[model samples]
Every structure is written in C-alpha cells, then in structure tokens.
Target: MHEDEWGEPGGGAPSEEHRDRHELSPHQGSGEQEIEASLRPRKLDDFVGQPRVREQLQLVLHGALGRGEQPDHVLFAGPPGLGKTSLAMILASELSASIRVTSGPALERPGDLAAMLSNLAPGDVLFIDEIHRMARPAEEMLYLAMEDYRVDVVVGKGPGATSIPLDIAPFTLVGATTRSGSLTGPLRDRFGFTAHMEFYDSSELSEVIRRSARILGVDLREDGAEEISRRCRGTPRIANRLLRRVRDYAEVRSDGAVTREVARAALEVYDVDELGLDRLDRAVLGALARFFNGGPVGISTLAVAVGEEQTTIEEVCEPYLVRVGMLARTPRGRVATAAAWRHLGLVPPEHAVGAGTGVVVDTEPSLFEE
Candidate 1:
C-alpha cells in the first residue's frame, strides 16, 4: 500500500540498497531513515499502544530465553504503519539476535529464499514483510524450513531432479502481512503466534504524537498534538508525517511553536480535513454521492471516475472510509453510506442504499420497469 510522503528530512536521494524497489516508504533517504529509526522504540517497554500484543510478545520471548531456544514462528497481521516492522526489530533486540530484513516480493525464486535462509546465524530473526506476496515456490520451500529447519534443494529438472535436504540454523521467522486472509491455511497454521494490530483510538494517537514530537524536538502543545492525532486516521506513521508538516509550517509561518490553530491551518494547506479525509478520499466520496447518487457502483467504475487504481482505492482509501462508517461494500457493488453524504455536506437521496432505511433501494433504473 502507498502512503503519503512527508518532505525529505535530508536532501540526499533514497538509496536503492536500503529499500525495496517494489515497496514505497513514507519518507526515504539514509538520513531520513536514521531519523525514523531514532523515533522507533528499541525495547518492548518503550513501545506504545497495543498493550495486549506487547504483553504477549514479552511472555513468548521470555519463555524462549528461559528455555535457551529460539521462539516460535510469529505472524503479525495488520494494516500499514501500526508498528509491525518496529515490533519485529524489537523482538530481535529482546533476543539479542541480529535481524535480516526482507520482503515476500523479493523472494521470487526458491533459490532466493534458500540463499537467505542458509546465511542466517542461529537465533537470528528473519523478518519477511508482506509475506502474503511471496512466490508460491518460495513459499512451499519455506514450509519445510519453518517446520523442520531443513530445506530440500532440488538439483536438476523433471526426472533427473534430486532433492537434497540442507539443514538450516535454528532461527526465528517473523512474517508480517497486511492481508492475513490471503495467507494459505498451512502457512497461517505454522505460526505459533499471530498478532492482529488494531487502529489506535484518539487518546492513543495523541500519546503517539506527543512521543514523536519530543523525539523530533518539536515545540508542541498538548492541544496541537491532539489535533494532529485526531486527523491522522489512527495511524502513527501519518501522525508523525503530519507532525513534521505542521512543524515546518509553524517554523516558517510563525515562531516554530505548534498550537491547535497552527495545526488546523497547516492541515488545511495540505488538504487534510478534520475527519482525516484528503483530496482523493473526498473525491471518492463525492463521485459516489454526486455522480452515482449514493451508488451501488462497481469499484472499477469508481476507480475510473476518480482516476485512481482499483487497488489504491480498495486498499488504501476504502479501509478507513469503511471504518468511519462512510462506505459500505455490498454484493452488488460499493455504496456510499448516509454518513458519507452528510460528511460531504450533501444530503443522501431517500432511495439510496444507506439512507437510514432498513431496505436497499435500487438507484439504477431497470429496462423492464415501464
């Protein structure tokens, strides 16, 4: 999923070696990376939010450490920017092991995964982000490696192929995916622990903003932090990004002091409204409410109307919109909820699907209905 970019902290261009070509980070640059890394909590105790996840992880890590063995295969399923990456790093730190970071899309061939697996030291943490996207062959190879710590390396083709079992180090696997439902049953079952990351509440997000502001040395007031947090869509990454933008505006527009009014003004300039909806978000809602008259329109049609990719609208924008009760996915198509129309300052048609009636009205005309 693509996230909005904040202004690059350092002027240097992004380094290809440090990031995947397929994946897009919020901000990029060796210097910018360092700044982001600095903001991440190094220890489990230092991590904020997800109280249940933090406690469960501590128990798992401690139990393994006490037994003098590697921990079980862990799976983190959640939306982007809820600290899945951070928790993986923290797990490694807690175990005092080195972490090898890679993503599923990068492991196209079994050989690619094999090479990485072979090089891992015992007790190392192998973090595979977007694990659901891994190639089928590599994923099959991983099954054995994850279960038995051995991989069958095929040395030839067809009838001449010979499977050679190679033993790998006893390491831990940490797989993260935004779409847990896409994971195969066998793969999901292999994980000893699976943590689902939830969206933060306003209070939690406000705490995140305050913590981030301190780390970045921004002169922020509580009200300013709360304002930014409320508009961040319950994501810490967005909160940090918005905080930086507000800080920039405060420095140039005022005296480097971030207050509630300053934050509102900055977000207005950036086109983020109080409900955390941006231009694209509003565009989607507007198209549904105006063009389709609160549609049961197909996602494809909506994408064309908004000039956005189907995946972008489906993955990035739709989740929050649906969570906020502004959108609904129906068997027929996508429909705008009554709350959506009201949010856009438009009235919902009485015959609309989500017009606060118990029944669904077909907005589209039927040829048979004379």
Candidate 2:
C-alpha cells in the first residue's frame, strides 16, 4: 500500500474533478503536521483529554528513561484525527530521544525499513502510522529488528546467497493504526501496551477549542467556544479545523471577535447544520430514505447512492450518526432508526421498528404519515 492508496494523493497533484465539486480539501498530513508546525503540545500536561492514556504513557516513558532502557513496543489505535501521532511525538520528547516518523505504506521495500531501522539511535522512537498497511516482507523484517535489535539482509540469488545479520540500536517502535483489528495477530501481540482513543465528549472538545483559541490568539467568548465545540463531531482535529474556519469568518464578517452568534452563523454558512450534519451527511440520509426506502442497505450501495467512498461513510460519517443514536448497524446492513427518520422530518413506516424490534413505529410521528 502506497501513501496514495490511503486515499490522499501526494505532491502538488490536482484533486480529481469529481472530488472538486464536494469542496473537500485534501488531508495534508495525519493531522499532526499542522499541530507540529503550529500548535503541537510541548509536554504531556499540555495535551488535553484522554487523561488515562496520557498518564499511562507518561509512566512508560518515565520508567524507560529512569532505567536507561528502551521502552516496550507500543500500539495506538483509534479513529483518525484523535492525536495518536501527537502522542508518539510526546513519547519521544519525554524519553529525550530523537524521533523518526514514517507510515506503513511509505516503507514499500524491505530495504526501506532496514535503512530506517539501522539509522535509529539507541532509545530513539520510530513512529509508524497506518501500521496495518505495511508490506508483508517489510513487516516480517520489523518483527526481528524489534525483538532482537538486529536484521538479516539476504544478498544475491539462491546459490550465491549471503545472509548478513546487522545489529541495530535499541530503539522503541511505536505503531499507530485506525483499524487495529486488521493487523496481523503476531504484530498485534508484540506490543507491550495498546491505547484505544475514543471520541471526545463535548466538554473535552470545548477544552480543546479553548486551548487552541488561546494558542491561535483568537478572542473567543465562552459561549463561542461552547458553540464551536458542540458542532465538532467529537474529534479534536475537527474542533481545531472548525475553530480556524470560524476565526476566518469572524475576522471578515464580525468585529474580529468570536462570539456565539458569529460561530453559529459561520457554521450555518458553511453548510454544517445545528445538529452538526454537513451536506454530505444529509445526502446520505436522504438517499437512504428516498431510494432505499429507509434501508437496511449495504454500505457499498449506500456509498454509491450518496457518491462518497464506503470508508468515508463507515469511518467518518456513520460513527457520528451512531454516536448520536440515529443510525443502527444491523446484521443485514445499515438501517435508519426512528431518530434518523425524525431527524430528517420523515415518518417511519408502519412496519419500521427500532434495532430492538420491540418499539412500535406508530409511537413516533412521521412527517410522511399525515
């Protein structure tokens, strides 16, 4: 898997024409690039939310630094934009170690991994993002290097082959993946600890927004931050992005002060509704209701129906809907529950029921029923 395979084209390549219509900007980095260049947390205490994970990571780094030993291999799993990469950098900073960053898809050949591993200083942190997408041969080479601090490079053809075992520095390997379940069992088991990042609550998001607003030197009223937080889709990255957009809107349209009204107006103008559903989100629901008859539709079909990628629907959009109690994943496929229909101002059919199959559809008024 190449970096392009992950759905983001590299270089200055122009976005495809079809994608241009949606106004979806290309992802520049793992969301860490912006943070690193601008707002990265310098210390663990500065990182907001996920207190338990932060504490555990702090202990790991402290113990390793105290003993002058390499920290154990660690895994961080979560949805995108949740600070996995940031945590990896923080680990390196805490250990007072040099850090090298790469992604699974970027290490295409075994030689690439070997080159990177061999150059690492003792106690350094080599952070691999999207670890599940690493090539098999490269992944195999990593196992030995991580376990024994050495790698065997085989040169030449079978008859004249020479195997050379080269020693590597005692560096810590930190792997981050959005889909940990897709990782091989051996790879998954090698990690000493795994941290699963969860969606931030509104309170946590508000804290993140407030912290970011301060860093960006934006004048944010308490109500303004709260309003922005409510529409952030429970992700720190989204919160930061929304903050930047709202700041721009405020700068041009208002007195350069971020207030509740300004935030609300900006978000509305950007097509993010009061409930935080964007145009694409409403399109997905509308397609389900109008075309699939409030389906139990397959993800692929739904994706095609809404003109978005399946992964986008599953990983990004569906999670929020599921979190808000509007969508349900059934054995058959995905179904719009009563809340979803009601959210769209549609009435559930007489036969429609909740995921439990016990609630009667008639109990809820449908816009279509009358």
Candidate 3:
C-alpha cells in the first residue's frame, strides 16, 4: 500500500507516532492535519455551514446514484478551512467509492497527472486540492481526461515521441481551490457543479465547537463553546484548533472544565483578541494606523513596516482586515479604515478614507463575495 501525505499507510489507521504527536500538540504543526481529519464529519448531513452548497450537492449525488453512474466533476472554491477537503471525502463516502487525494502542486508534470489518472478505477473519486496551482501541462492534460476520459501518453523524446491515446477508467474529479479566479476558464467550465464555501457564522461555529467538544471528550460548557467560537475567525478548522488549545489550558491551569472565564484567560495568553485578531493581525492594524497614519500605503511599504512578506500581508492579513471593515483596497493601495484606528485605540485622522462616516466603504471587491 502507498503512504498518504502524512506518511500514514493508505486505507489504514494512523501510526502510533502520529497519535503521540497529536497528543502533544493537537492543534499545531502537521499533526493538526491528522486531528482535523478525525474531526471531519463523515456524512454530508453532519457537515456544518454552507447550506446552499449542501442542498445542491445532495441532489447531484442522489441523481447520479439513481442513474448508477459516477457524478460529474465537482469544484469547491472558497477561503481555506471551510471544509473543502472534508466535502471531497464525504463525496466518496456517499458513493461508496475509493478516493485518492493529491494536491495541484503534487501534479507538476503531464506524466505525473497521467500516472494518477491511469491508476484510478471506474467510479473512483480523485480529489485534487488547490487545483488552481497545477502545472500548465498537467492542467491541459486534465482537460482531455475530464471531458473524454482519455490521456495522451507520449513515448520517447521530444520530436521523436509518439503520442499514444490511453483510455482511462471513468472517475469523478473533485477539485478544491482557495483562488478559483486563478483557474483557467476552460478548467472552471469543465466542472459540472461548483460549490462556493462561505465563512461560518457565530452560531454555526458554536455548533461546530460543540460537536468537536463531544468528539474530543472536552468538558466544554456552552459559554466556553461560544467563547471559543467567537475567537475562531469564522472557520471550522480554526474553531477546532482553538478548542484544542483551550482544552490544553483547561487541563493544565484548572480543573479541566472549559468555562467562559477559562476560555478568555486561555485566549488572552495566546494573544487572540475579541475580534479574533491574533498577533499578526493586530500588528498589521497597528502599523497601518500608527506608522502609516491610516494609510493609502503600498503593500510593499506596509509589509516592510510590519516585517512580513507582501504575500502574507495581502493574503492572510488583508482579507480579514477588509472583511471586518478595518481596511480597504483601492487603486492607490491599501488603506486602514476608521475602525482600524479605533481598534488600535487611536484617533483616525480627518484625511482617513472612512473618517467622515466612521465606516469603511470598500470600493474594491470583498474577499467574502462569491
């Protein structure tokens, strides 16, 4: 049997080392992947949030089952930590089919993708995460496989190579991407159905935390669940991660009961604020408000001020900041809103973008917009 990405044997239980490592830090490092997998809902009904997507997907899967055929290629696009990967697994489970998991980065060559396609059995589910990042050649090869269930296998070198058309087993392709816009139009169009995952609301995340608490055997009070949910940044993955951290603190610092007080104390120690703004998040806000004077500053300048990579500033910090009305993107550059100043306990300058209204009017496209 082949090894999974975590080095665990495929189709088998995780190794003892994985268990021990998970015990050590249930929410940190690569071990978190294993824990998250365990926490994922095996059935679609058990999955939290994105009700529209769930309803749409149920019909597709049921219709395909009635026809006794594999469902069409499905695409899941949204921000990370919203159960894309989990949904892919659930699709396989619903069909009672085997699933093979790989990421776009893993399929960098046409041959690499060809090998994966050739190995799939009929009705198998091939899940490719971060599909937008797949190599150009691999992506082109996939177009043919997705439409015709055939791949051109070239033998020998370059000009002397012979292109052999190999018919592969018909399988369902499930693609997940955080940046669907980066995907080619042809690739996007090929997907028979697309599910856009949304950020979990407070109530949904509280339910998620409760479910996870039961699974982890944590003595989490309702208030504790609510507290953790509020600070989880609207993502189930983050909710589970924070719950594990809170559990650790409860076991060590108290009688192991996670109440509101305990959760707050634990989060305070970990530097997560009321709005779920962590160290980096606050740092970005502080820099924007204090250093750049509620800036229309370029991302490079802001990144330098915060000593972070531009990509980190753009992808990680900017999205949430923009979402919560603390920042804005414009033709000029990034601008901190009036809320950012207030959050940092500073007064916004009169020249600030949203200073007059005290509300950030985002002219640029929102990160949460579908």
Candidate 4:
C-alpha cells in the first residue's frame, strides 16, 4: 500500500486540514514507532515477498527440528523494514525455542554477552538486531560462542587475570543488520548462512496490503490495493502504512470502502504524489534542482540546502531516488540525474563543465610566475 497510509484511522473521516497538518510533520523517529507497532507481521506466512529467503528458512527450521539440534547462526542483511526481525521471531516459534532479543549495542562488554549466552537453554534463539553496531569485545565473545559453544571470561584485570572457560548451551544466533558490509569478515563468516533481503515488488506489496486489510477488517477494493502498492516504494512496511491511510480516507470521505479514487484522494491529501514522492522527497529534488543547479552536490551540502538531516537525506530519501534513477552517486558526490531535472521541470546547463569533462579554459597566471 501507499507509504502515507499506514496507521491512519480508517475511512476519510479526518478533516482535510487535519490530515494535511499531520502529513507536514517529519517521519523520523516519532511516527515510525507507532507504524511499526501497528504493521509488524505476526506470522511467517503473513510476511510478504522474499520467497527464496522464506523457502530457505523453512528448510533450516525443518531440518533443525528433524535432527533435534539448534539451527545454525543466520545473518539477515537488508534495508530497514524488510521483516528481518519478524523472520527471526518466526524461526524461534517454529522451533518452539525461547528467544532472547537484544541489539548489538546492548551487549556492551564480553561479560554481558557471556552472561546472556550462559543463560540460554539449548535450542534457544539469540536475536541480535543491528549486529553491525556491536562492541568489539562482545563480538569477539560471540565468535567463540558461535563456533565452539564456549566463552572465555577473564577473572580479573591486567596481568593478574586468569581465563575461565565457561560452556554455553547450543543456541542459534540470528543477526540482522542494515549494512552487512560494515560487519568484520570474521564476524560475517561465522554465520552459517546469510540471507540478503530485497524490496518487495508491487504485486507482492499488493498482497501485503490485501492481507493487512483483511486482518484489519477494511473493505479494500483490488484496484485500490494495487494503486497503493504501486506507490509503496517496493516496501512492505510502506504498503501496510498506505493501506491504513487509504482505509481512513474511504471511511471518512465516502462509504467505508477503500476504492482507487479514495486511495488517490488520501495520498494526494497526504502530499504523496503519483510517483510515490512524498513532500520530503519532492523537497530533496527541489533543493538539488534549484540550489545546486542540478547538483553535483555533496550529501551534507544537499541536506543543508534542504534543511533536513544528512542521515535522513542519505538513508530515507537518497536510496529511493537512486533506485528510481532520479539521482546518481559520483566520485565527487551526489549528482541529480537527467531524470531528476526533468521530474522537477528543469533542464541542466548545456555546458555545465562537470569535473573530468576534459574541457580546458584559460586561467590568469600568478604575478610571481610572470
């Protein structure tokens, strides 16, 4: 479904002005928590798309069950909101194993991870979200735990220390990260299998919308779901969010039925245009077009130009822009592609003289040289 729709009250019941006011706010750390709570997939079957990953995971779980052993460590890498956490939970459920969930940062010291490992029962799953952020000491402990089911804890500091070898129960470790490349090679290689998740296709997102709608008990027409899915940026989370908004639109504005017209109206009211570009998206493009003269601008410069955070520009906006071919990354920085210029109804200078164009111009000589 549409990115703007999720967690909205069903039916277009909210006043246009109210909706507009809400849409104008930033979508950073605030709204996402609510959206995530509302839309997280509760079951494996409900997790849309990533069929290959699903198949492989099912086999792993099944084999583990058949052999009465803990499944091997699994590493899931992808952009955010791709169901890595949900899949981890499902794996734990399938194995009927207790899951201890924590982020990399939570386990600050080797002792912290060692304690957690020591407490785990056999076949339990330890899910580490944002594993790339784990401290070096904790990561070192994890390597031994994963490889040999043991942790060596130093009893005291400095030269007086003696190492204590503590055995831990055989447990499965599931790691999730947005940037797998940042993980050390040793850490990366420790996982028995790595699953790289990709964005959902429109069809997959539509199914996600339909499924969510069914669960939420909203009457969503097929075309309406499809329309929302098309603008969901190939993300299941966005699709679920869009469904909620469209449902609100349908209920408040018209009959409590989500139709294509209702979906379009809801998205328009939310400042989500036809190309799935929200207000922030358009603002980024506008900044690149107007300020930088179709930008070969650095990310920080672009963020400053747009009055948005650099991380927001780089993570939330830039990836989609680059994916849709509206932006390109160059050795120098981010450059607005021709498509970006056209999308903003602007034209690049005919002879903009980009770096490495090999065109030379006369320059003034220094007085000392003369």
> What does each candidate score in C-alpha RMSD?
5.1, 6.2, 6.6, 7.4
How well does each candidate superpose onto the true structure, as a TM-score? 0.90, 0.86, 0.88, 0.83
User: lDDT ranking from best to worst?
Assistant: 1, 3, 2, 4
* Model 2 Cα lDDT, one tens digit per residue, 1-370: 0111012111111222122223224574554345434665767898888898998988887887789778899899987667787788778888788999888888889999999998998888999988988989999999999899999898998799998999999988999987799999989988988999887888998988888888789999999999998887777776777787899999999998999999999999888777778887788888877788776777899999988888768765787787787777765667777777778889875445463456543333334421
Spell out the clash pairs found in candidate 3.
Answer: none
Q: Give the winner by lDDT: 1 or 3.
A: 1
Query: Which whole-number lDDT from 0 to 100 does residue 234 have in model 3?
Result: 81
lDDT of each candidate versus the true structure: 0.83, 0.77, 0.82, 0.76
Off by over 4 Å in 2: 1-36, 355-370
Q: Judging by TM-score, tell me the better candidate of 1 and 3.
A: 1
Among the numbered candidates, top lDDT falls to 1
Please give the range of 10 consecutive residues that has the lowest summed lDDT in model 4: 8-17
lDDT per residue as tens, model 1, 110-212? 9999999999999999999889888899999999999999999999999999999999999999999877999999999999999999888889888888888
Judged by TM-score, which candidate is best?
1
| Lowest lDDT block of 10, candidate 2 | 1-10
- How many clashes (backbone N, Cα, C below 3 Å) per candidate? 0, 1, 0, 17
